[model samples]
Target: MTEVLVVGAGPVGLALAADLRMRGVEVAVVERRTDPGAGTRAIGIHSPALALLEASGATDGIRERAVRIARGEARADGRVLAEIRFDRLRARHPYVAALPQSDTIEVLTALAPPVRRGVGVTSLRQETDGIRAQLDDGGEIRAGVVVVATGWSGRDLVYRPGAVRTHHYPDRYVMADVVASGGPVARVHLERAGVVESFPLPGGRRRLVAWAGTNEVTDADGFLRDAVAARTGTPVDIAGASTFGVRRAVAPALRRGRVIVVGDAAHEVSPIGGQGMNLGLLDALTLAPLLGPWVRRGDDAGLARWERDRLASARHAARLAFLNTMLGRAAGPSAHAARTMALRTALRGPGGEAFTRAYAMRFDRAARARG
Candidate 1:
């Protein structure tokens, strides 16, 4: 049997693979996709996750490639709502990096060699000693441990098909990421109509994620023009467009037998807080330490510690994702009252920093733990 089988090539799987390799553990990763991501979905790498990447000896590449947003803001109508500076909030990694999910994965895959693409896991059986997986390629692989990073694809392995639990909201957002050829774009810019987030990637290309509407945005050009028009009263062009749904789902536990779930598989969230990938990254830190001894001496204490120590954090990540999504859709009388009071008390003054810091993962205890 192999040391470990990681069942996805996404960021979570690759990251876990990297951590395992760093600890001198043999690992193999499988990706169902034939290639890297087509567009940018997950953006904004926070300070905590940056530290994790740094520890893994992969930070220099990402740091050199990504654009830094010293601060971020949330706004409404024509009035400026809240502007919080991430650089000043925490001292570790002073800025938020704006990069695409593809670039992030690319960096990670390079660091972690031998990711099997176009390979899908079909079935998994676990015993007291190790686990075995069936690949759609009509092959079998055995490992002492297997991590089910397959995302929604692995739901059946844990629960009945279509039985995964999820919480969603009515509000939706349209997103687009493109290379701005003109000049260095604004670090973090948001208007009442929506928000524009930018992060530079390797090869002089920058990634941008913009949310132009709360409801279904019909006209791509119109939304771009309107977003710029509403914010700056000027015209702007949207060179590329990509749109996807926003959702939140959390499994009760991240592990069943030797098969463990991480990243989008264990928990997924709306893009409101930009914590989805970061949550998965944290999974590496929290779970990696648990697998070292298991691989070194064929012991299970390290693996058990991984589950025990990481469980609460995983649940909290899902819970926070839920709260952030709900807060994004907060409306009607109750939401209005809350937002209004928030605007009156916090958003208008220095208290505005508190709201921003809380969301930026700055105000939390030990915010540098890969989340």
Candidate 2:
């Protein structure tokens, strides 16, 4: 029997599998898709996440394909409202590494246990000694422990026993990667038009995200160009475009019996701070060590502790991401003015350092204690 069966070979599952295998735990990973997703869903990897990846020996490969962003600027009306100098952070990777999520997936998949693609967990049932997962291909997996890292789908499939609350913000945004020449700095513009943000990716490409109000944008290319021009005072060539909603949610619990959840399977936050992937990586980092011990010794107490710590951390991250979305989606002259003033104050004082550190997810007391 497999020591651990991880469902969904996304970043979280892959990271956990790699960590557990490195620790000498037998593991297997399954994914529903035969191929990796082409979209660049989450693009920013912060300092703490970089540290985690470095420990797993994946950061060098990731950095080879990623662009290092040294600073983050907030602008309004073409004026720089606030600046976050990532260089001020004390970590070895003081900058945010901007890489396409596809590349990230590649790096993680290479490090993880061999994945069985086109295989997905259709249902899960807990037995006396382990959890039994029914696969879509008429196969069943019985492991000492099961990890649900299938993102939002796990909310219904795994957590149906309890209520999961999701708060959808009225904000809608369109994102695209375009060919552009800019510094290694990420910028966010909170203007009356909307919130237009840009992050530099590798190979002279930049990712642009712009708020498009409550309505679905019909012309993503046009909207992206106009928003980019309005926010950065520069117009560039568009490569591709997509749209997404801003929402926050948390699972009722991170663990149910012998099965556990991680990543978007357990919590989801806004993309404003690019914390979704980083948080998911942290979840894997946090759970892997505890899970290995629990599976080896049948230590229910250790699993319970992991559940408590991870749940609390997820809630905190979700709240922070919601705040970031609210600040970025703020509109009108007064709202913009208030945001500008707040940013100015926060960036100029000690509060600015705290904010940036928190955004980087380096200020978690539990994480520090664990380290």
The number of the candidate with the highest TM-score is: 2
Tens-digit per-residue lDDT, 1-371, candidate 2: 79999988887888888888778889999999899787777898877777777666888988899999888887778888778888888887888889988998899888888999998788888898898889999999999999888898866667665478888888888899888877798888877777888899988888888888888988888888887786768887775688888888888788887888889988888888888888888888777878777888876666677677777777888888877777766477887778788888877888888887887777653446432
lDDT on C-alpha atoms for all candidate structures: 0.66, 0.82
Reference-based TM-score, model 1: 0.83
Candidates in order, TM-scores: namely: 0.83, 0.95
lDDT tens digits, residues 1-371, model 1?
78888888877788888878887888888888899775666766777777777756767777776777776555544444555667676457777776767878878888886988898888888877788888999998998888887776677766665556776666555455544442333333443334555444544555554564457766765565555455444444666555556776767677777778777777776766677777677666567767767655776665655555455555565566565555444245555556645665675587767655655655333363433
**Alpha-carbon runs more than 4 Å astray in model 2:** 369-371
Q: List the residue pairs that clash in candidate 2.
A: none
The per-candidate count of clashes, in order, stands at 2, 0
lDDT of model 2 at position 90: 81
- Cα lDDT for residue 61, model 2? 85
